[model samples]
Target chain A: MKLKIWLSLATISVFFVGNTAFANEAEETVTPDEELYDTSILIEETELALTEEQMERALLLDEFANDRLSEIEATIEEGNIEEAEQLIEQYEEYLERLESELEESEEEQEASEEETNEEDNEVERVELPDSDDNDENEQGEDSDEENQEESAEDQDKSEEELRESAKQRTIILQALLEREDLPEQAKAGIAKALENQKRAEENYLRAKTEKAVSDEDEDEQEQEKEEEETELQEEREEEAAEQVEEENDNEAVVKAEQKQNKAEKKQQKAEEKAEKKQQKAAEKAEKAERKAEEKIEKAEEKANKAKEKAQEKQKKAEEKAQEEQEKAEEKNEKKQAKKAQENRQKEEKKNGKPNHQ
Target chain B: MKRAMMITCLFLLCACGQGEDATNDDNNSGQTEAVLYENDVFQIEEIDGWSVDQEATAEQEQNVIFSNGTTRLIVSIVSKEQTIDTLKKDVQSSFSKKVELIEDDENYIALLTNRKENIRGDVYFHQGSEHQLIFTFMTPEQHYQESKNQINAFNEGITIF
Candidate 1:
């Protein structure tokens, strides 16, 4: 009886949670991509994604931006031509701000993506020395770093999504602007929308140039990591050689040590040669494969060209045949008509009807 | 090897020879076509199988009308006395709602109109320093497909010297 009561409680709680999920989804009036011009969800997502400073610039790009352009067009449609110029200029600033925001976000994303890419590079090059225990320890440490890095990557993905949303909005605005059959009054609004997009693009390029100067820091970090790895390996080699040197107490021992060092150097040279040969072989195979692919593509292109030429020739031949047949048919009809006219003339003469008539 | 090459050349020549014959036939078809009308005043060079109306009694009639059976070309000289807007308004009213203003500007305004009885006319209004000219070419819908190129050529051939 107690078990049954516990089961009933669990079932009731599950039903309540399911109902809550459905109710939450039903609250949204429009889903993404339902309407190209509708920006409800995208605006909400963007507002969430942007920081406090960025939010200020993003305000100009609100869904209410369409209202100002619509108002300008309404004024123009009312035949207020003189005020239209001033209205267009006033609306241009808001569009400029929105465009700059788009650009700023894009530039910031590019800079942040470069930094993440460098970190990924450093993580990739973190291969431990030839020791299993060291490798295992380093692997565990790398996994933890990777988990932390994943959150940073998640931030980048969100930034990318925001940029994509901005691009979609810009494209939709431009498409609405390109309607030629639209009235001149309505054109003012479309033009303003386009102007905003253009201003955004320009602002992005300007900002990208300034941000590009800072991208050198990520490159320097990558170089520093490579230097650190090389220094660490050199230190390990020196420590091993020092241990061997400390044991050299007599002449025979020193000579044995020198011989051992010479043998080791010879093995290292042979290993380097083997590695070079293997790399060259791989390169040669890749080159030959590429050449073979190119040759096949060239053969296919030649065959296609020849086929097209032959088809064109055949088409021309058929057209000529058709025209010749038409000409023969026309000539035959003309001859038959002439002959029938002669027969009618003979009959008319026999009946004594005047040929002149 | 030489014999094989000769055979291949012959085969290709035969394939393309039909095109040459068609081209020759096309040239012959046009060679038989003779000119019928040439006008200097309304700045027309030549027209095939068409003649200017030489029987109009009214001297004040500012129109030079060309005819080939049912098809007609009527050129009205405006003398820059009226604005292009007036001409636009006049055509709009004459053709009513279905008149499409294809090209509209200060120097040139062209209108295409489809009227009752399957008749369609292409009207061009050209502006010059001394005079404005309106040319209306009217044809039936059946004849339009064949005569469109001829009409375009006639319009292009007119020089206002």
Candidate 2:
């Protein structure tokens, strides 16, 4: 009874002490991330955990194999070459099996991915989108001969209009996307179709701009010719006005002053023409600036898409490399374990305990 | 009260005497059987008056006698290296028992006490060296010299592979 009482007291004290020790240990080891990060970090952490466990297993196997190899070395030193050779053969066979298993799994993954790709491509496509619906509808029902002629004319008009619009849109969009003043967020929102449209707008705008510039130059040349013609006509009119003034001078001096006023009117007209031309040039520059801004935005969106794709590719490559490393480690571990077991047996035999079945 | 004390004293003496008698019987039987080392190193038989202290280091055993008829054979294998004198000193310090040094050569050799009460033999093989053997024996002082002939017979009897 006394001994049992003492034993119970001892057990209670031991339990109390153990609990206190465990609580103290737990208090001392508070990890920072556990307190800070969310559950996704934990999930990401779980991915690493699997590889770590595999690596740890591999390490154990490596140690075991190394120990076995050392024992084999010892045996060789003891002139037991036959036994050592047999151990080496066993180790090699185990490693080969491990390597083959790794290769087989990798092949299986590749085959499955190939099947998925094939299935995706095998999806049957149906009809394409309507490209000429508006034109077809406009050439309505009538006598077949009239309708066919009208239809052809409408088709030709629609084709020309589409071609012209496509070129104009590509130029405008490209110019807008290329503009430096555009914000980054604005650039990201442009879609692939919008990009294609912008390209067409930019081309059309460039052609239109070139045509307008050439037309303006032609108009300037025509104006110069008209100015020369008008100058000659003015000379004639001035001469006639002077002649009229001379004829009127016999009647009255006030009539002679009207001839001098005609020259001042011509000068006022020339100043007005110059002011109007300056205003037109300023407006054209503004429109070009807007187009340039849109083009800049489009280019930014394209760059962002490219960057995202490259990042995704890099992430996938990293995942593949990690998987390969894990597989290799697992193979190594299996090999190591086999070696360790053989080594352990050899050690036991040398120690004369012969721990075999 | 006096009678109770007397009875308790008598009971204690009887208990001790019976324990001694049982121990002696165990010792005699153990001496006749061969001593087997854990590593299958060596075995010796027919020693006289053997006793074993089982509470030793996990890897080793100490102080057991082998018997051949009336003679006692004591055997020990030491697997560490030190001078014979140093080993003798360490054993004496650790075990607190004097070892009679008989043939103290490069490897270990020590004989047992030859008196009738001290008829115990001892063998010390330096398991320190890769290959070294030592064997020692003791008998009733009358048979002390005669025990060498019996000890030599062990070499002839042992078959090493």
TM-score of chain A of 2: 0.27
What's the CA error at residue B97 for candidate 2, in Å? 99
TM-score of each: 0.28, 0.20
Q: Retained native contacts per candidate, as fractions?
A: 0.00, 0.00
Q: Compose the digit string of candidate 2's lDDT tens values, residues A125-211.
A: 222346455344334323444754664465345335445544443443344334344444433322333444445445444544554
DockQ for model 1? Answer: 0.00
- Local accuracy of candidate 1 as per-residue lDDT tens digits, A1-357: 999999999999999999999875333223121221122222222222222334333542543244344444555556665555555564565566665665565656567676756876685567556756777766776886686588557545544554565565555544444434445665666555555554454444444444443444446546657866786697578768866866664566776677789669868866886696578656755665565556556645754564466567658868888999999999999999999999989999899896775
Off by over 4 Å in 2: A1-252, A289-297, A300-304, A313-357, B1-161
The 10-residue segment with the lowest total lDDT in model 1 chain A: A31-40
Q: What fraction of the genuine interface contacts, i.e. the true contacts, does candidate 2 reproduce?
A: 0.00
Query: Where does candidate 2 chain A have its weakest 10-residue lDDT segment?
Result: A35-44
> Candidate 2 at residue A47, lDDT?
20
The sequence of per-residue lDDT tens digits that candidate 1 reaches over residues B1-161 is 99999999999999899889999998877644433333343456556656776653133255666666455666666656667766555543333223466666664555554322234556677765577777766665567777677777677667764
Q: Categorize the docking of model 2.
A: incorrect
